[model samples]
Target: MSSLDKRGLKERLTAGENVLVAEGYLFEFERRGYLKAGAFVPEVVLKHPDLVRSLHEEFVHAGSDVVLAFTYYGHREKMRLIGKEDLLEPLNVGALRIAREVADKTGTLMAGNICNTTIFQRGDKEAVAKTRAMFKEQIEWAVQEGADFIVAETFSELGEAKVALEAIKEYGKGLPAVVTLAPQATDKTYDGVPMGEACRQLEEGGADVVGLNCHRGPKTILPLMTEVRRACKGPIACLPVPYRTFEECATMQSLKDPITGRREFPVDLPAHLCSRTEIGEFARACRAMGVQYAGLCCGNSSHFMRVLAEGYGRSPPSSKYSPDMSQHYVFGSDPSFKKYYQEGLIETVSLNNKV
Candidate 1:
């Protein structure tokens, strides 16, 4: 709409361009106090639409190539959990409209998003039907709202992910779909499918891009991406939460506070957040592995997104604020600084370094 290139998600990927999509909306909105964290229903779309739009604008300016609708957990189940079922349609439509506005204004792709319904049951036929219905309605709204593509993400089970992809293909009516799974502590879907096989299956089922997202952080997720890249033939997406997860705490949900020895997920995870350098490292690894779709999940910020963009060989508008430590009073080497006032600074720093 802003006279930017009209290429869709699939076309850009096909043209060998890496796409950066900024997600982590649930956590970001909660941190900003616009949405409640426990239920994470995303009613902010209906209550404070301007905030959602501003967040989308921020992500675009920080180098996101897509303005993904913040419809995560805006489904009937989540609404019912908070007794806001009446706001379901309005919330979904509102989120889509807000994202559409940002995408049009920023000339970024607008993506309609549907995530795994937590109510999905492996063997319960009724539950499975309900899950499909949830996906169907959201996809319909996304299509009707003129979404450029669909993103069905964070499915913890491979079966549920396939259902989402199927619904996207059926209800999306030709819009490309990006399906990403969130593996649990065992490095596999809750249903026991390995991450790589799961992504491969999604690719076979017609997902334009298939890979992992959320739940895990860079250290834990990057190793899994290796298998995903090897198994999938088409584009792969890697969007991990910006936390410091490792073998001990394989996923953020399992992270423990070093001092308290209690799980610190959802809340109190700031203590373990990954540095911008780590996120940049993740982006470099993603580019090296040929991950066509790269991004951060929960705990992402505009600054982190900028670092990721730089690591991907992109200079987003927000990069203008990237840190320049060379100007630090104690560490600066700029010739214009008066040497008399800072002559003893380097000696003092060296003395302090002595352990």
Candidate 2:
């Protein structure tokens, strides 16, 4: 195995280097038919270990600097929701081990994952305690498996975000904590805390990196993230869903079908995915704004990741196969190409030319 972490994630970020993290395991695995969409628990880590490892490899090849564990929704509450509370410990351990193996082999940072419990309600001390316990076990397993950092992501409630940060500080064994929140359609956390103030609080609470992830797409999230960048004194992480969220529908959940006017989220959002070029543009924008850490959240794929890498001025392993339209048979301008082929290509391929 290759040596891991020549320079740690925090070290690189502190040195002004951008670290690309590939998340979106919940949606990616569901699309692959291994994970259930509604529940979204990462049983694939235990049931389909090879697939999980393969995805980690794909992200690494596509230029991801961090191999985030596929434990996004593998918390105690989520597992218990699906009546597999028995699988909680095994699932978390299995996911961490898979991520560690890949990170070690490829010399990338391995990040343990935790997300919102969905059970935490503000001012409810009982719910807060339950949330803490859930985070404690996951952090314990992550630290035990040698994770380089802990990524607490997709929490829409700022209250819960602090709890996750607190848990990380207590149980993370001094590893870096990357806490990213998911603001709702209002452009604020579910608890009504503005995005900037929320991120500011996280940084003040000792988070290594603070920003937003999930829910909103690139266009919608960037404006709020700008506020975070200005508010926080530390590195900021921005990983938006690869979708084209607009003014009317500022988040994937708020997206509506053009014809049917029905909701198209979770399972029916393929038509709304952002093109590779769009992702590249988003990456370039982030870099220009001095954002230190970047990546895509849900709806992320390897090709999309390659675009992000290239946008950030990186050429990952997959870049070797990036598009070379100049070499296309129908559009080639190379000297060796037949002039007749290029001249008639539009006429030959155009549907409008058909009799």
Top lDDT hit: 1
What digit string (tens of lDDT, one per residue) describes model 2 on residues 1-355? 1354478877898778899988888889899899898888889988889999999999999999999998888999999999999999999999899999989899999999999898998999999999999999999999999999999998998999999999999999999999999978897888888999999999999999999999889999999988998899999999999999998899999898999999999788988999988899899999998888899999999999999999999999999999998887766667665576766776666856675
Point out the worst 10-residue segment of candidate 2 by lDDT.
1-10
* Candidate 1 local Cα displacement, residue 311, angstroms: 0.3
Predicted candidate 1 versus true structure: per-residue lDDT over 238-279, tens digit per residue = 999999999988899999988889989888988899998899
Candidate 1 at residue 243, lDDT?
A: 96
Give Cα-based local distance difference scores for all models: 0.91, 0.91
In angstroms, how far off is 236's CA in candidate 2? 0.1
Residue pairs in clash, model 2? none
Which portions of model 2 show Cα errors greater than 4 Å?
1-5, 335-338, 348-355
